[model samples]
Target: MQKSVFLGALTVAGLAAGASAAATLDDVKARGTLNCGVTTGLAGFAAPDANGEWEGFDVAVCRAVAAAVLGDPTAVEFVPTTGKTRFTALASGEIDMLARNTTWTFTRDVDLKFEFAGINYYDGQGFIVPRALGVSSAMELDGATVCIQTGTTTELNLADFFRKNNMNYEPVPIETNAEALQQYNAGACDAYTTDASGLAASRATFENPGDHVILPEIISKEPLGPLVRHGDNQWGEIVRWTLNALIAAEEYGVTSANIEELSNGTDSPEINRMLGTEGNLGEMFGLDADWAKRAIMAEGNYGGIFAKNIGENTPIGLARGLNAQWTEGGLLYAPPFR
Candidate 1:
């Protein structure tokens, strides 16, 4: 009958929608590359090296994900996205995930139809001014020209901070961190405002890094992370657990140097499950048993990545304050592998 055919058609449509919802993983496997969105260029976060090889903290996440899914850490297309273009790139499927210094906010999470995989960096908005400017505090910047990245949480936070202090300032909006650096260096803006970690990265690139000082006040909490499109729960879980694997690896003392040895077997059940020596954890996410192992091996553990790229010895010189493991009195704690 016509009614029976209509019911069957509805069932078929539902099945098709479900399939499409989980399509990213299969698409990525077929393509053999993970398109990862990152910042245009931020020192110690994401940027090309002397030989034009992409290398940095955020870049490592992209490489790790590619290794987990594609079995090759180098199988990644790093799409450079500014503050405005990053979201659109991810939404349009131009990129599989965004690993830029994007903050996890209420509207961005709920209204933007994106799922934040996890917080990679706990950050806060702050300001930097040249030491010659004699501005020791953010409150002293009333009526100053502030260079801020457009389409970011810093825009609103800058407004709120000034408003709270009964201050007013001229906004000098820039699209990228590089532009902000240019404008601020050229005296187009009196101060540059962004995440504190970003300020450190920027200052490290300055000709006279000692000539500038980041203000003491941190205005807004920026829980920066990687994000994927919302509908693909399977893909989201893969990315989420990939990052968790790195964190847990660091917590359990599994470094790149030791990961292979540990993978042979370990005393800890959690380590065994994570490294695929025990349990079907990777199969649960439709991947091979060695997915997490590949991810960990690709970039070393999260702690290793941090220490190499942005730690005190690096140009960025960011101390592991809030980003340290929970057992080390920091905010990082991953779920059990089992």
Candidate 2:
């Protein structure tokens, strides 16, 4: 009787969550804008420009989703969230989806009742220190003070990495990347730890970026991506496929430069289906035929977005490494659009 009662309650809870997720789609459509949660400020990932317009790799995902759903990429309100507030904002419906640099963990996915749409960036935790510290590797810093963002997986990873190595250290807790940068620059911490990509992003903003060197040790696997509340399977699918559309676009040679022409007519059946020329896939998500087309046009495909924001040429200077296309020896492989 206890098990049966618990199962019943679980089902009811799931249905309630699903109802909320379903309503989010309608609410966004009715309001004609997407409320997307983003980092307070992490250059090359998500941050405001001099014009006060949000633009970056992560911001592109939010714009693509807005374009896919509303056919207007600009129809979005970017909500700045710190590591501590991001999940709460998403859970409270303050944001329709979260496009922050959040890792997909088991607890956040199941226990926290959230669903990661898909992995956009394959990252790992690393450390950055001033060159003057003479620390060439993470293992060398035994008693160093570390600046870590609170309410993030990095905190636990920081503790675990040190404990496993039998090292002792002092932690300087911070809430945002800006704070970590300020504290680290002010000598409040000996080292700053976060996703390797983030370290690069933060370092790029330094007065003399070459003054700091990121350690060689990659401490944790952080598959970062967008996420939505669980039990909202349909909304989840919309976000998932929208991201997939961008990945598939890159793999199939559908770029922002050629997407419109290809959408009109393409030789590849997969491209045709994805661009909504040969199938009713959009109907599956309650969107129009040109949904994926609009998404790609919003900020180009995944590779394009990456190159424009954090690629080797950019100040953040990230390479395609693991984020490259599956056909090119990376981990990015999108399911067939058909």
Task: Choose the strongest candidate by TM-score.
Answer: 2
Query: Which pairs, if any, clash in model 1?
Result: none
Candidate 2 to native Cα RMSD, angstroms: 1.2
Worst 10 residues of 2 by lDDT: 16-25
TM-score of each: 0.95, 0.98
lDDT of 1 by residue, 17-130 (tens): 667767999999999899999999999999999998899999999999999999999999999999999999999899999999999988988899799999889999999999
CA lDDT of each prediction against the hidden true structure? 0.94, 0.94
Cα RMSD of all models vs. native, in order, equals: 3.1, 1.2
Model 1 TM: 0.95
TM-score of 2: 0.98
Please write out the lDDT profile of model 2 over residues 41-87, one tens digit for every residue. 99999999999999999999999999999999999999999999999
